[model samples]
Target chain A: MSAREEVLARLRAARDVGGSTVPDVPRDYHRTGVHAPGSAAAVERLTETLTDYRATVHRVGDLDGVPAAIAAVLAGSSSVVAPPGLPGEWLGEVTATVRRDDPPLSVADLDRLDAVVTGAAVAIADTGTFVLDALAPDQGRRAISLVPDHHVCVIRAADVVSSVPEALARLAPDGPLTFVSGPSATSDIELDRVEGVHGPRRLDVVLIVPPRA
Target chain B: MTTDLGMPTVASDPHGHLRGTEPFPVAAHRALADTQLRQNLGHATRTIRAKRAAVVGEVDDWEELRRAGECVKADVMARLPELLEQLEASVTARGGVVHWARDAEEANRIVVGLVRETGSDEVVKVKSMATQETGLNEALGAAGIAALETDLAELIVQLSDDKPSHFLVPAIHRNRSEIRDIFLREMPDVDPDLTDEPRRLAMAARAHLRRKFLSARVGISGVNFAVADTGTISVVESEGNGRMCLTLPDTLITVMGVEKVVPTWSDLEVFLQLLPRSSTGERMNPYTSSWSGVTPGDGPQTFHLVLLDNGRSNVLASPDGRQALHCIRCSACLNVCPVYERTGGHAYGSIYPGPIGAVLSPQLTGIDGPDDVNASLPYASSLCGACFDACPVRIDIPHLLVQQRAAAVEAHGRPTAQDLAMRAAAAAMASPGRFSLTERVVKLGRLLSRSGRIRSVPGPGAAAWFGARDMPEPPAETFREWWGRRERS
Candidate 1:
């Protein structure tokens, strides 16, 4: 028998001899956030949690507020990488020269850029995590955000969910996804968390909230 | 009907020198004397423990989540063969190749062959315990490939020519100054004025690794969770080195134990919540990169998943002991273990250490008939029950430790003095007559008492027990005698 067959055989024999019992999974845990889905409380909790993780949170009233928030976050940058299909108005007020990644920028090209701005697929309020599916129009290939030094992710209030399960429900499982919680950080050195290691050192989350009635 | 694959399905002892030659006690004794190691472990474990407790306390359904996680793993184990077949088909359909290895040697050979085919003399690596378990780096080096460890802690361990002492922080044993010295002495282009500050140290490593990440052709990693339904594999990490290696390389090879698979993408919902809070005490790790087999013009276009069984089947064979496979490699058990906090990771000898390692290593090596060091691992713990409490999956590590101890004792052909004493005590307690006779004999031991305590005794094991504690003097009357007098009255 090949190694595969032998291994499988052994597993089968073990299962037969031991007769392992599978238990029913109790999933009584909170699958949804305690706060109502897409409620103001959820967005507020997300903002606070993201801030706690050291990601600068900028609460914008709407899409119109996004450009100014982007500009403020990228105030010192000379050049920025914007993914293809990103709303043109989002970068309208920024003085930094916008570099479109329609053809996709090289690693060196991205490394030299000062910042990256993209939209998120969905955001989890409880865990303060944001998912970036490469197939999404605003969230380009994984490299665009990874190679740059700073990232400014735009999260609409509607896209913010209460928990990880809610966030997973919104994502397409087949696409490559990166769930980012904070700026690249490491507790590897003496188990002391020192933010900014290999990925973007600075993360600015622009929360686009809808106008209240 | 039987066909030989020219490889031993049941390896006599494939771990070799990796399972350190000395038993745990001797090694732990040497480790105990290192006050520096003890202090480093104490400080790190305490800090992580506090953070984990705070975050875990915030989750109201933490227990429910743990139970669900355990069930998912148990289901996976019960139907492992079918699930693996499903995983193989899904991955193959999505442009990934799957290879199976029965033991460590075959796993190493398969990995080395893949690197040779890539024709890359050097490979960048994420911090992977699977690779460490297989000793893949040593195998790759022998085949003329330099496997550069890219994770910050792994880099420290690699550069200093030391083994990883902790799971999350491999260099947890090294202080800031020691890390600085290692970087300065080993890193080729390090700054001359590098201080011992952690931020400066991180910056120096980032600069050093950037060049390698940009140019690497092949990257190697371990799987945190493999989604059998979607053919996706996820790696949870803090630093961006994992992202760099997983994305920049043209070819990627991942070595995953069969136990790492979960049934569906939705199952990740439970683990994603459990792992981060349990391991690093983060709401979520800094980065969790998940990719299905291969994506065009994005992450590695060529992907290979190596399914490793190196004694996992043996572990699955026992009904009472098989829950050991439920571990998520969170190292929560290690952080809370009283023994591990004192002796550190080296004393366990395997790349795996602490409470989980004590039960895991011996079974993974098949301790049924051996008097080797692996058998000694079953006795490495104090059975304090901290590891089980801290385990996110609730593996019941102390129960497994006791079970493995019984198996080890049964395997020993000759009974030791302690075993003889235990047998005699069991026999004496079997009946009221025997018990009363033994109690009468025990009253004679009052003669050896000095000032109401017996500090020493003549038995081989009694000396060691008496060294730290004193035995109390026997009571004047047996409990049975008192019960009979009361009944008469």
Candidate 2:
């Protein structure tokens, strides 16, 4: 028999011999947080967690405040690239030559740029994490967010959720997704956490709060 | 009703890392004798333990979450065959090919062939326990392809030609100074002025592997969780190397144990919370990358998923011992195990070294007899119940350990002297007359007691058993005798 057939047959036998007792997994664990998504408390928790993870956080009052926040985060970066679908107005104040991924940038193009700016699909306040879906035009492809040393991710105040399950519920498993909590870090050496290895060493999370939905 | 369910599925991959090299006692004795290793193990485990406690303590519903995680894995085991079928179809529907391997050799062959098809002479690797278990790098090396390990700890072990010593930190046996020496001697372009500082050492590694990650055509990795419902496979990692390999390579090959497949996408909710807090003592890992299959103008358009059995079927056959299959490779059990902390991971002699490895390795490759190296694993644990308590999935590791011990005794082929003694004791205890007579005869041992303790006894394993501890002297009078005297008074 082929490997697939043999393995399946063995699993079936074990099921038959062991008795069929499908377990009922309880979902009593907190699926949503006490603080509502995008609430003041939720935003406060997000800032605390992101700061603890060593990501620089800047909060702006509204859509108009996003340009200055993005500009300040990318101050050290000479060249910045934004997804084609990313609003042109978000980078209006960015002094760095803001390039658009119109034709879709290559690895070489992403390598030369100092930083990349994009919008997040959602952000979790409890874990200080954000999700980037390739299908989200604002999020662009996975590589664009990965290659550059500095990643300036713009999260709207309303996107923040309280817990992991709450954040996961808003996501679809249909395409490539990246869940980033902090800048690259490792605990390999003597089990001590040292940040800045491999991925973007400098992660500037810009939380835009105003223009309330 | 069933004629053939595949009886001898217990044999593991010949090239796999399941079997230990030597007996546990002997290897552990050698490891304990090394003071430097004991210090290394103590510091690393203790550091991780404290961090884990702090993170896990903060969660208000931690126990509830662990329970849900445990039950979810149990559900996956009950629905194993169906989940795997769904996963294969989903991955295929999304333009990814799937291959199945029964053992280690087959897995190695299939992966090598896939890499050869890509026609790349080299591949960059993310740190994966499955690859370590299958010894993939050696197979690739023999086939004239280089598989460079990108994780800092894995790279150190690779450069030194040493086996991994821990699940989370493979080079825990080496301090920063030793790491510096290894890098200076082995790495080709390392700076001469390198110090033992971890930040500097990590920067050095960054410079070394950057060219490889950017230029490599093939990337090899292991799956953390594969969502059968969506054909999505996720890799959770801390360092950016995982992202570099998963992102930069043109073709990607993922080797996943069949037990890793979960039925639905939502199942991730329980495990994601359970893993990081338990494994690395962090609220979240630095990055978690998941992709369904191929995407145009994106990372790794060509993808292949290899489903590995390698004696997992053998583990699944046992009624009670099968819970070993629920492990998520978090290594929390290892950090809390007293035996592991003292003897260090090297003593276990398997890629999986710790309380989990002790129960898991034996079940993966059935204990043939006393001489079967994996047989000693069932006895490696002190059965303090720490492992089960620390397990994120609540595997009941101590219960499983006893079950494996019973299985080992049954599979011994011939009874040992200890087995005969146990049977005799059981028989004596079953009958009232035999029990009374045995109790009466056992009190005669007071004649040999010096200070109400039996320092030595003569039997098959008595000397070894008495080496570490002394037996208390039997009471002079039986309980029934004392009861009769009291009644007469």
Compared with the true structure, all predictions reach lDDT values of 0.88, 0.87
lDDT of 1 at B374: 74
Report the number of the highest-DockQ candidate.
2
Off by over 4 Å in 2: A211-213, B1-8, B444-455, B475-484
- TM-score versus the correct structure, for each prediction: 0.96, 0.96
Question: Model 2, residue B82: what's the lDDT?
Answer: 90
In model 2, the Cα lDDT at residue B474 comes to: 91
State the lDDT of candidate 2 residue by residue for B181-216, as single tens digits: 999999999999999999899989998988888788
Q: In model 2 chain B, where is the ten-residue run with the lowest total lDDT?
A: B1-10
